[model samples]
Target chain A: MSDVFLGITNGVLYGLIALSLVIVWRSTSILNFAQGAMAMFAAYLGMTMSSHGLNFWACFAIALAAGFALGGLTERVLVRPLYKRPEINSIVVMVGFLGLLESAAAAIWSTAPRTLESPFSQIYFEHHSTTISLSPFALFQIISALVIMTAVGAIFRYTNLGLQLRAAALAPEVARLLGVRVNRLLTFGWMLSSAAGVVAAVVISSSGSIGLSPTIMDGFFVYGFIAAAIGGLESPVGAVVAGLLIGLVQQFLQDYAPSGISSFAPVIILVVALMIRPQGLFSTTKARRV
Target chain B: MISIANLSVSFGAVHALTNVSFDAAKGKITAILGANGAGKTTLLRTITGLEEAASGEISLEGTSLLNMRTEDIARAGVGHVPEGRGVIAEFTVLENLRLGSLAAKVNFQDGLAEQFELFPVLGERRSQHAATLSGGERQMLAMARALIAKPSVLLLDEPSLGLAPLVTAEMMATISQLCEKQSLTVLLVEQNAKSALKVAHDAVVLHLGNVVAAASAQEVASDERLRQYYLGLVDQ
Candidate 1:
């Protein structure tokens, strides 16, 4: 029972990360390999600011702003120049960025993992003589994820800016003909995605004493990639739902299945899910070619 | 007037367009007829700044458009309805129309009323995704999307492709009507020379990458050898 609740909370965090990847992929068709690195970098920035006795929310906000700046800068400096080249070139560039950013984080913050305590209490509740996994911080993480989901949903579904972003992502040539500043929109996509990654990092770290390291987000990045893939890489809502399902499956396997077998659940599920529904679990239409 | 002088474009070892030059007079429809690989689409692409010219120049009202970006060209009052309609299938018709108005730098609200007036069917299905639209509806949406920008020069590429004869005639009529009403300088690229010549005031025929014939639409329509040999038009 506790494992199920744990899975849900953990899944929400994974979904947040998956949403970030989906945001970038939907916009540029490039799986952002540096997403986790960018999130970790921003998390370290928040850690540094908080270490100086800054307000927790203020530091978090600052970290998100930093993520936005970094994402925009990376797009303009690294991604934009390579855009005209073959798609493989952009993939290589992103992989290079991933290595550079991880190394940079290590060089700056050292190889040692530092403590990153959540603002909320980590104490679990007791109900019916059973230990439940719903901690104050865990609940906070779930609510935060929900809020982010709702906000993102509204932005994409209702706003004019969202419409422009969709058009730009789906048909850049057509969008350009319609006077959409596609270059700016692409940059904006990266900025929003990185900011989402920052939120996921902060929330995920706050759930427990998962000490921060240069590669602290490696696991999250992997799960997020799997989650995004399950969603078919085009649907935002699909990514979140898939992330939650993956978490539940992972938790069930860990609690009941053999320890060794549990590790392969995500891969097995990914393969099966892809084979069955390549478009995604929630995808209503096949992705339109630009 | 939109003028192309000695315009040439090459892709590595291949020249897509070679010294092709013509003028699309203001308030007139200039149909560009060609066979496949005749550089009809390439010419429109170059004028819209989608393709870079290796040599020569393009200017609208004496303003040189060389080295200008596509957005800049669009901002300079050039609207392009690319081949395949380029209607964003994911977006609704209203959103597509809104996107076009973005290039015009005007609020779409004012233009939306006018667009709905021009194509009443579009109004009925404005909220529907472009993918759901039929071939004819998509073409109308493409034209409406381009026209909403209120461009001084409209570059239309193969608007009649894949549409039925009646739809093609209606589309051409709408285009000619728009040109007459707006005094729009138009470069209409089409493989349907018969339908195209019916609405065009002037015509340029291309063979390979070079202009093979340039004359009035009637003159080009009347030349049996040129029409038969180049345009694939069989005289009745």
Candidate 2:
């Protein structure tokens, strides 16, 4: 029973990371392999600020803004050149970015993982006989994920800017004809998704000691990618739901199955989910040509 | 006024347009009639700055359009309704209209009420996404989008393609009225010879990327031999 709760919580975190993946994929049709690294980088920035005894809220704000800036800059600089290239080329560029950012963080911040403590650990919830202390990290992770989902959904449904952003993704030539200022929109997309990644990183980093160490983020990247693929790469709601399911699966597997095998549940589910619904859980049957 | 000289585009071995040359005078509808793959669409694309011409000079209103960007070309009074209408599907008809208005320097938001009179169907569907629009409605929205841009020259490629005869005729009438009302210079590319000729003031016939004939619309329409021989259609 505890395992179920644990898995569900972890899955929510994974869902946030998955959300980042889906956001990038939907906008540019490029799977950003570096999204995890982007998250870790922002977390590293927060760690630096936090180590100086900065307040949690301030660190969070700084780290998140940095996320947006880094993402926007990356889109405008490193990734913009490959925009006209094929999807494979963009994917390769993302891989390169992953390597470069990870290595850069290591060179500057060292291979050591940093301790990122949360302020909300004081809160507690008793479930039956077991007591679940709602750690600051978990509270932030769940709330932040929900917030990201709502904000993104609202923008999509209610705002002209959101509609324009989506139109550029679904039909770029048409968007251009409408004079959408395509370049600005691309930067905006990167910033929005990258900011989401930063929020995920901040929440996740608080759970464990993570350093400027790139490998500290490697596991979450794997899990996030798996969650995203399982949920369907294109749908935001699909990714979140898939993330929660993955979380539940992981917890149950860890509790019941051998500890070693449980670690690989996400991968197994990833393969099965992809095989069953290649388009995604949420994607409709209608094939979109553009 | 629009002029293209020495316009050519090639996809490796196959040449799409080989130094295609033509002129569409101000306040006139110049129709280009050619079979599929005859570089008709390519010509329109070249004009719209979608394709880079191998070497050419495109001048409009005494200004060189050479090496101009597509958006800039659009801003500079050239409106292109590409083969598929190029309507942003996720945007509502009103949003789509506003977007087109945003393309030009002159804001058309104030003219929305008046413009609705021109495309009442779009007015009725002001809040619906363009994706849900029917084939004819989609074509009308596309045309309305360009018209709202208030362009000096309207470049339409295969506007009547994939539309029913009645719908096509309605589109033709809308375009004719637009040309008359706006005194708009239009470059229309169509394989449908009869209707294209009916609406055009001048016609440029192309066969395999070369201009086979260029004359007044009345002269070309009256030439039964030319219609049957060059255009591949008999007048009703």
**Highest-scoring model, TM-score:** 1
Q: Whose lDDT is greatest here?
A: 1
Docking class of 2: acceptable
Runs in model 1 with CA error above 4 Å? Answer: A84-86, A125-132, A260-262, A287-290, B107-110
Q: Candidate 2 residues A166-281, lDDT tens each? A: 76777777666556677788788888888888877777666663423666667877888888776767677878888888888877777678878878877888777656776667
Candidate 1 local lDDT, residue A42: 88
Question: What is the lDDT for A258 in model 2?
Answer: 80
lDDT score of model 1?
A: 0.86
Model 2 stretches with alpha carbons more than 4 Å out: A1-8, A49-55, A122-130, A208-212, A256-262, A267-276, A285-290, B5-15, B18-22, B88-134, B148-152, B224-229, B234-236
lDDT of 1 by residue, A184-236 (tens): 98999999889989988777555456767889888888888888888877778
